[model samples]
Every structure is written in structure tokens, then in C-alpha cells.
Target: MKPTFIILSFFFFGMVLHLHAQSKVDSLTYYYGVVNQPKSNIQLAKAYNFFTKQKEQSIKRKDIEKAVFHLRLLASIEKKMGLLSDSEISSVEALRLLDGMTNPEMIKENRIGIYNHLGIVYRSLDNFSKALEFYSKSLELVEDEASKATLLNNIGNLYLDKNEYSRALVYFEEAYEKSPRLDLKMKARVLDNLGLAQAKLTLPGALSNLLEALSLRKTIDYIPGVITSYGHLSDYYLDKGDRETAQDYAQKALEQAKQLNNPQYLESTLATLVLLNGTPEVVQYKKLRDSLEKASVRAKDNFEYYRYQFSEQQRLFEESEFKRQKLFLTLILVILVFVAIYVVGRVKHNKEKLLKVYETETRISKKVHDEVANDMYQIMAKLQANNETEEVLDHLEAVYRKTRDISKEHSEIDVEGNFSETLMELLKGFNNDEVRVIVQSISKVDWRHFSNLQKTTIYRVLQELMVNMRKHSRASYVVLKFEQKGKSMAIQYTDNGVGTAIYKKGGLQNTENRMKSIKGSITFESNNDAGFKASIRI
Candidate 1:
């Protein structure tokens, strides 16, 4: 064979591979965007197929990021479909791929996403501790208020499932406060959860929150949320000694559950109605609930079996990929040993220069957009005045100085050793003349047990929480307590401030993300009446 013909064949092979990979990625990205929408299972199934193909292509191309992305998507779909075991396997596989990559940022969002999804799966499987573990892991990685709010709510729900009503109530309140006003569905769910938790505790606002949640759900046409709300309302009214109202709401919930054909809600509503109305209908509802519960158990068993089979198939595919990668690596190593041994040496230098250029460009763009451009625009408005030219010049100078200060702040982070000491110092800084800051058991934690990275995460998390308290809580007293629990350390923070609604913000999100990166967990507790309390575990 001629050398030129051989080169042409290689080029064709490369082009074909590139096109195929691109196609798979495009398909996966498209499906990912719509996976959560109503009636999207069909599209998700198509996306799943593409994800499998992408995995194969990624393995062939030795692209760890792409492979992780594919596995993450697969896990998400599996979780959505109630295939908990399969979802867990896919998520673990994706996390494993991170070990081979230099930068995990490409799939950072997905990594935390899978953790939260796995938590949901575990929660569904009735593994409360495992669910909390995964949720905590996700909380550490959550960077946005919305995601944090969702995770907090999920954790609260897990506590609800565990029958820890007080713990659940804390998270529910935080989630309700932090969630955006625009997210009616989420807010309704939170309200419903709060109502349930409150009702369990026989709290004063249980009926109001539940009724409001039901109204909101009905307004938004969220049938599922409304159904759950009905059940909660029935429970609340029943507990309030109003059997008539309870029976009415229970019947309404049963009707909706029947319309939706949801066995879980059907069983719940039927059981509630059986207690409320002790007629001959009680016997029929009990029988129906028992039968449906049995069927639901069987269905779950079958789903698990199918998930097992799917996992076996995935295992086989991975085996094949491992073999293919081994052979591919051998071939590449042989070729590179001779032709590209020296070529690889300059790659790092070029990459570093490119990265520096990118960083500088990003900083300049952000400063211009966030500060310089807005300042200039204000200056332009002021320049419309006949005698405002000098004022405009002064404003421009101020903008420049502000921009320079911001740039410096952005570039430099106050990183210190001695995690406990640093944390104490930071907390002291927040302890103003009005705010009486109390530190408890700070010396009890064996900070030596944690690595610098873990310590740094702990410091930063406490700092963010305190900043939030100072900025929003307006509390006069703050308590910081540290406790060592077996191998892990826990920090409990409480504040007596005017606790307001918590929302997703960059600082809180970053704190969560930092904790997530270090596999630590943080929980926020607050209410309109009670002051704010936060618990951090590492």
C-alpha cells in the first residue's frame, strides 16, 4: 500500500469518527434540555440510546469527560424511570471517570447532579441515611440558590420520611423561603411539605400553609401537588377533630389519585378515608389499598429486576470498552514513543499561556460588563447636563478605582492554615459591637484529622454562612459550636436575627459548592419567628 493512500484512509477514518461523536453529543445535549418537561419519556428514551452510543464513541476516542457526561445522562433517565439500582450504577461509573480527567469542571455540574439524583433514588428505596448522605454530598457542590433550595427540601423530605418531624420542618421552612416566587410548582411542593411537617407537630400554621399550597397547585394546574396537598389537608382536619371535612378532602384526594391512577396516592387517600368514614365503604377502601400496595410492591420488585439486567448489560459494555482502551492505548504509546516523544513537551507551555490569556480576557469582560460599562453609561446620562463634564470625569476615575479594587479582590483569596483558628478569626470579624458572637467547643474538634482541603472547605463554609447571617439575618446574637462525632466533625451555627426569606445567591451557592467538593454537608434552619440555625458536617 502507498503511504499517501494510507494517510488518506486515516484521514477518512478520523473524519467519520469525529462526525459520529459530534452527532451523539448534539443528540444528548438536546434531550438533556427537555428531560424534565412533561411527557418527555419518549424523547428521553431516544436520548438514552444516544448516550449509550456516545459512551462507546467516547471510550474509543479516550475522552473521559464525554464518557462521564453520557453516564450522567443515563443515570438521570434511569432515576426518572424508577430504576434506582441502574441509576446508582450509572452515577458511580460517571464519578469513576472523573479519576482519569485532569479537570473535572467539564462535568462538574453533572457530577453533583448525579449525587442528588442518587439521593432521590435512595430516598425512594427507603434508605433514609443513604439518601441524606447523598443529599449532603450534593449540597456541598450546589452553587446556585435554586439547586441548594431543592436539595434542602429533598433532605427535609428525607427527614419527613424518617419521621423526624422537627428536623424536617427546619429544612422545609428554609426551602420555602429560598425558592423563587416564579417557581410556583416548587413553592407549592414546599408549602405542602411544610404543611405536612407542621401538621405532624400540630403546629399553628399547618392548615393555612396546606390550604394555600392546595390553592396554588390548583391555580397552576399541578394535579400531583394538589393531590398530595389534599391528603395533607385531610390529615390536618382529621387531627383537628373535624371528621366531616377530613372525609370530604380525603374523598377529593382519592378521586384525583384515581384519575391519575397513582397507586401510592390512591393507597394513602383510601387509608385516610377508611379512618374518616367508618361505613361499609371503609372495608372496600381498605381492601383496595391493600391490593394496590401489594401490586405496587410487586411492580417495584420487577423494576429492580429489570434494572439489574440493565446493569449487567452495562457491565459487559464496560468490559468491552476496557479491552478496547487497553489496545488503543498500546497502539498510541508505540506510535508516540517514536514520532511524538518530543512533541508532547511543548504542549503544557502553550496550554498555560492560552489559559492565562483566557483568564485575563474573562476578568476584563466581567469588569466592563459589571462595573465599567454601567459606570460609563451613567456618565453619559450625566454628560447631558451643560456643567457635568468635570463630574463625568470624576465619576470615570471613581469607576476605574473601583474596578481596580474589585479586580484585586477577585484575584486574591484569603487562604490561611489552622482551620479552626482561621474560622474563629473570621467569626470574630463578623462579631460586631451589637452582635454578641459566642463560640462553643471550637477547641474540641480534632482539626488535625482533616486535610488542608477539608479544613479550607470548613472555613469557607462557616464564613459564607456567617456573612449570610450578618447581611440578612440582622441578628444580635450568634452562636458557633463545634462537635466531633466519631470520625467526622460537625459545626452548629445559630443566630438571633430578623430571619428573612433565603434565596439562591452566588455566595451561598459557592459555599455549598465548596462543601460538595470536599464531601461535606451543610443544612440551614430558620423561620419567620425563630432565628436562623445552620449545621455543617464533615
Candidate 2:
């Protein structure tokens, strides 16, 4: 029973490789043929070396399809050599490469192939549940009839290994029905499996199907399929109480297994021959089985070591990438902080420069008013007392008034006092009998929130506007309106004067600059025969 089942398992694996090989191209096809059917360990080792180098080159070039192609062939070779654990690792690596790939067709095809290969690998490892899981996954991805038939056959083989002959027959029958889509070699393999499953259940017609499968295999010269057919025929005859006929078939299986040069097939055929011809062959079968089992154990251990090394390298690479990203963020944050500091310092420097210039102008104006204007006032009084020319006295009076106006324009105001009252006084200074000045909503504004720089800017800007209006505007009435909107204070000034088209010069430009220095804004609007208007906001 053991020898017959072993032969069945061997051919099932052969069928799996044969189906998988149909899709290979060019260099991959050449390597697969060499590795899959190696005549010696040295030949397999050379093929392994070539595939490893090709896989590495493909990975370096970012060619995912080519890398996975090499991995699939390498897994087939590893499983053929009884390195079940290594085969499992290779198949999983190939699947990992397909993960998150944008190409859906490529992902589906490669994943189906790897999943089917993993099912075969796990079955060889005696992990029946894992084998079923992979087989089901492969089945889900298979869109083609040939691939579905192949998976069904593999599933049937799994049930056969568990001795569930009835359940195995169901899958085998379905696979056989699907065989028209498969090639002649695959059809022979599926028919052979179907016959074996039926023979295990002692079903009728099993003998005719087995003979037919053998005849099909012979037409194609498939040696592995012929050996499997002979082994199954032997088991069927023995089950029916025909010892002599079974022995004849066992001898034929042993001859073919030897010619094939596969140690596993030879050992299994010897086990069958021992059952028929006793004693002599028992020792050889046990010795060969023990040697193969030890080699399989060593292969599993080597695969575990390789897997551990791969995991460690992956861990180190992720840790390095995480640190690199962290460092980059830290650098960006530092640069942003430096930029904020530079901007604040530049604004502070400009504000200080503006304040210094204002103070200097105030000092010079005070000097001119105290000495030069007072001297002119005393000269005018002396000319009046001495009865000098009336024209000279009038000229002295005009000069004194001009000097006082300059002193008042540059004078610093007491912002700590009633600033609204100070602002109104400054605005009303332009009023006379010919021109009337109106100040509106002056007390409505809350002046406590304003800084000294802001107060000085507002005072200077309004003074410049009034001086410009009084000097050039031949207007009868002037209006100054103040209001608070949101977080800002706004002042609007208008006059029914002959408005000039030319603006943004002399005192008006100076007014614009002063408003800007304190982060405020002022706009002038005028046209011929239209009223002059100035709007200020801070």
C-alpha cells in the first residue's frame, strides 16, 4: 500500500511541474528544463547558480516578472530534490513580490502559479491542512479551464493521501471531465489519477481506464506516467487476490523506476517488490528510506536558517528607513523656526529706525521755533515801536507764522492723555471764517488699545492731509469722520474743494509712508471738479 501510494505522489508532483512549465519563455524555459530534469546533482547545482544570478539581476533592474519567473523554477527544483521547506520559502517570496503590484493580470497569473506550487510543497511536508488552503487559493484565481483541471487533480491527490478514496474519486472525475482543455500528457496524468482513485474504492471499469491511461502515456513516451500506471495496476490486482499477476506488474514497475534514476521512485518500487518477493529487498528499501528521510530533515534545517537571515536583513532595512525620515522632518522644522525668527527681527529693526527719524525731526523743529522764530517776533515789535515801514512789519509777521506752523507740524503729542481730543484739535486747526471744519464720531473710538507708534502715525498722517488741503484746496467746508470697525480704527476726510488730479506727491506721499511704517493704510481719491477724499485704517 505504501509503495503504490508513494508512486502516485511522485507522479502527481511530476504532473504539477509539467503543467507549470507550459507558460515559460526563452531563458526561463531553458533553465527550467535543465533544473526540472537534471541527470546529476552537479548539473542541478550549476542551474541553481545561474538562476540565483539571474534573479539578483532582475531584482536590481526592478523587473518583478523576471525575478518571480526565476523563483518559481527554483522552487520546482528545490521540491524535486525533497527540499520541501526551501520550496515553501521560494514560493512565498515570489508571492510577496507580486503583492501591491499595479498590474492586475501579472499579479493574478503569478499568484495562481505560486499558490499551486505551495500546495505541492506543503503536501510533501505532510502539512495536509496547509496544502488544502493553498490549493483552494489557487483554485480561486484560476480563470482558465486547463489551470482549474490541474488544481482539481492536485486536490484529488491530497484526498488520496488521506485515504479518503470516495472523496478523492469525486475530484478526480471532475478533473477528468475537464481534461479536453488539457494537452495529451496532462490528459494521461489526470486519467491515471482517476483510475487509481476508483481502484482504491474497488469500483468497476477501473482496469479498463488504467489500461487506457497506460496506452495514452506510451503514445507520448511519458516514462513517469508509465511507471505510475504499472504501480497502480499492481495494487489493483493485489487487492483482487491475484498475487502472481500483481508480482509481474511490480517487476515491470521496478525496471522502469530504475531506468528513470530517481531514488524516491526506486525505493517505492523496491517496497512493492519486497511485498511480492519478501526478505531480500526489505533491507534495501528500509536503508534507502532512512537515508532519504535524513536528507529531507537536513534540507528543512538549512531552509529555516536562510529564512531567519532574510528576516533580520528586512528588519534592519526598515529601521534605517524610519530613522532617515525622522531626520528629514527634524531638519525642516529647524529651518522653519529660523525663518520665523529672522522675519520678526527684521520688522523690529525697521520700526526702531522709523522711531529714531521721528525723534530727530521733532528736535530740529523745536530748535527752529525757540531761537529763529522768537528772534523774528522781537524784530517785528521793534519795527512797530520805531515806526518803520508798514510793508516790512507785515513781512516779519508772515515769516513768524510760517515758522510756528513748521514747529507745530513736527511736535510730539501726549498720547497718554485724551488722544481723541488731541486728534480733534489737530483736525480743527484748518478751520477759519471762509472754511468750516467738522469732526464726527471722535469720542466713539476707543483709543486705549493703540500703541505710541500707532498714535504718532495717525496724528502725523491726518496733519499732513489737513496741511495739503488748507494749502491747495479752495474748499468752503471740510469733514473728518472717525469710526471703529471690527478690530481696526478708520478715519475718513473729505472737502468740497477744487480737487487736483495729481496725487501721491509731497505731503500726500509722506502720509502714505507714515501709515505704512506703523502697519496702517491710507488712500487718496480726487478728480477735477470732484471733492478730495482721504481714507485711513489701522
Candidate 3:
């Protein structure tokens, strides 16, 4: 062949390979997004099929870069879907592909992504040491702070779980400070880890860190972290025999668990609730555990769903999640905005009714005190001057009867509206153009079920939450949900917001009181990069 023809041929081949690589990335992302939405196993099955073919074809083409990328994804997805050693084989294949790459920079980038994933797989397998080793390698080749910070955070968590508090803090703080960008989950994890470390140090920072992390989780809707943080706090208080504080935190954690639909968390929260001073915590624990066993079976029945739908289903799932999120927000706006208006109307109506009662009672009281009393006085004067004692006594009796009726009218209390309406309003307030919001609301109930005092208290709790989210959380997305199960209603809110840098607990006290007043409950979570989550159960 002529030299010119050879050069052009090579150029064309390289271009094809590059395009193919890009295509593979697009597919991975597309499929990954689909898995994020609500879907059936048919989807995952399709994704697994498509990607599997892509991986095989890439290997056959000797396109190592593309091959490894697909393999990494296949591994990760397999692990998450509960497929065992097959995922590990994919990771090994990814590393094998790397051996063929010659360019140093390209190799570094690929290796970083590969090793991070290796760490994920190993961590899932409980091979923490190997996970740590690969994560460290990924860190060494890192060009971006975000990548390094995430690795550091992961490493620190591994150490924390191993009970090496001091070592954990070193990496945790390093990641926290050096990380230019943070995620909600990462930040919450760091804060919670920091709290654990600080507690060991006996620093005032411990409580503050715990509280800050707890609060941030609430703002950003980091439900799991919120629940964990509360449990930690409850444990801290429990050890100290601060029954009141322990009970408060325990209750908060339980509320969050219910909101998240996490049976495992609820089980723990129920156990803690049993320990609270007033309730029969043991009874609640038994009941909760029995319920959890049943739910686990249900979850398991749906477990293989993701595996079977692995391909096209995954794509659809993500699209559905996006659409569902938008629809959720729209529904929230319609329901909560209307409910808020309803609450406001109810509040006004009650005030009006109360005022009418006050006015009528006042008018009657005044009539007895002023007009009827004067008549009695005149009768008494007549009795004294003209000897009419019997008439004076009769007038006094009539005046007393009128005064008693006035007292009865004024003593009655009527507060009849739906607390759900008020909660809906509070959630609706969190929705703004700066962020997207998804709401899943339970049925609205009659506020009349609650006392006047309870109504005011719960409203204030939700208000405190909205205020923190709007003011402190720079969240672009929020998820508000309400669900009713059996006798209880869970009002849950979550957001993806970078919230409080440290502990913020002043608002939580009010939140707790509001739930407690209505015999309801709350649980929440928050963090630096992710956002916050809180559940109010009534």
C-alpha cells in the first residue's frame, strides 16, 4: 500500500475507535440513570444484556479502554443486584485491560476510575484492606480534588468502622477541608464520622459535630444519616443517663426510619423507643420486629425484579424517575399549596369562631354585671330602704344564673381543621425555582382530631424545618413525602442541599415538641454536601 493510503487508513480507524468509546460511555450513563428510577427486573435484564454484548465486542476489537469501562460498570451493577463472584471477575478483567494501555495520562485516568470501583467491589465483599489499597492507588493518580476527597472519605469510613477513631479523623478532616466539592452523602458520612471521633476525644466538638451533621441531614433530606446520627446521640445520652435527651433522639430516629421505609432502621429505632422512660419500649420493639419480618419477605419478593430487567428497563427506570420526580413536585404543589391555604383558612375560621364566642360571652357577662347587677343593687336598696329583701335576693339569683351561662360559653374550645393541611403548606413552601422538589403526600386528615394546643405546636415544628431549609440549605432539589401506615402518618421531607457546616440543633427542639404534642413522631438526617431529611409522624 502507498504511505499516504496507510496514514489515512490508520486515521479512520482511530476515529471509529474514539466514537465507539464515547458511545460506550453514553450507554453506561444512560443505563445507570434508568436504574435509578422505579422499574422492574425486565429493565435490568435488558441493560445487562446490552452491556454484556458491548463488553464482549470491545474485547474482540482489542479496544481495551472501552472494554474496561464496561466491565467496571458490569461489576458494580452485578454487585448491587446481588450477583456474587461474576462482578469480581469483571473488575479483574478491567485491570487486565489496563495492562494493555501504553499512554501514561490516559492510563492514570482510567486507573483512577477502575481502582475506585475496585474499592467498591472489595468493600462490598468485606475485603476492606484490598479496598483500602486500591482506593489509595486511585488517590495517588488523582488530578482533581473532588476525586481525592471522595477516596479519602471512603478510607476514613473504613477506618472508623474498624474503630480506629484517631486515624479516621485524620482522613475525615483532610477530605472535608481539601475537598472543593462535596456530596450530601459524603458530607453526612464525614460529619457522623467526625462526631464519633470527637466523642472519643471528649471535646465539646463532639456534640456540636453530631448536632450539626444531624441538622444538615434534615435540611438536605439525608434520611439514613439523620437516623444514624440521632441513634448515636441517643446512645450518648443513654450512657450518660440523660433519659429525656435519649428519649428525644430515639424518637427522632424512629420517625426517620418510618419515613425511609427502612425495616432495619425501624427495628433499631423501636428497640431504642423501648428504652425510653414513659413507653413500654419492649412491647413496641416486639411489635415492630414482627412487622419488619413480614416486610422483609415483601422486599425480597421484589428483589430479583432489578436483575431480570437489566437493560432497557434500566434506561426506562431513570427516565421514569425524572418524570416521576417532576410529576411528584406538581402534585405536591397542587396538594400542599391547597392544604396550606386550607390550614390558613381553618386557623382564621377558628379565630373567628373563638372571637364570636368571646364576644357573645363578653356581652352576656357585661349585661349581668352592668344591667342586671344594677337592678339587683336597686332591689337591695329598696330592701334596705322600703323593706323588700325578698325582691333583692331574687334579682341576685337571676344575675348569677346569667353569669354562669357566660362562663360556660367562654370556656368551650373548638379547633377543627386538618393538621395535614398545615404540613402540606410547610412542604409547599420549600418548593422554589432555585431547586426542584418531589412530594409524595399521605391523605390529609381533620385537624379537629387534635387539640388547639397540638395544632399550633405541630405547625411550628414544620415551620422551623422550612426556615432552616430555605435559609441555610443551598439545595436545588427536595423530596417531600407523606405516607400513612396502620395508625400512624409519616410526614417526610428530603433535599439535596449543601447545608450547615457544623451542628445546628436549636430548630430540632421545636420540631420535637411539635410532634410530641400531637403524640406524633419525627426522624431526620442531614450533611454538608447532600442535604437533609426529616419525618414528622402523627
Best by TM-score: 2
Tens digits of per-residue lDDT for model 2, 1-538: 9999999999999998877776445556666777755555556666787788878998999888889988888888788666677777888788778754678998988989988998887777666887898899999988888999999999999999899999999998998998888988889888888988889888888988899999998898777688889999998899999989999999898898777776667878888887777775675777687678766764554444246448768878889988998998899889988988997787787689878878987997898899989999889988899999989988888999999999888877878999998988887788889899999998988887788888888888888888888888889999989999756989999999999996578888888888887788999889988989999999
Pick the lDDT winner: 2
Which residue pairs show backbone clashes in model 1?
140-512, 140-516, 141-516, 145-504, 178-502, 475-497
Model 2, residue 95: C-alpha shift (Å)? 1.5
What are the lDDT figures for the candidates, one per model? Answer: 0.75, 0.84, 0.70
TM-score of each: 0.44, 0.50, 0.39
Q: Rank order by lDDT, top first?
A: 2, 1, 3
lDDT, candidate 1, 153-213, per-residue tens: 9999998877999999999999888867428888888888998999999888888888899
| lDDT (tens digit, per residue) of candidate 3 on 241-323 | 79899999899899877876545577789877875754576667776876786465334433221243374467689899999
Candidate 3 has its poorest 10 consecutive residues by lDDT at 300-309
Poorest 10 consecutive residues by lDDT, candidate 1: 406-415
Q: Regarding TM-score, does 1 or 2 come out ahead?
A: 2
* Clashing residue pairs in candidate 2 (N, C-alpha, C atoms within 3 angstroms): none
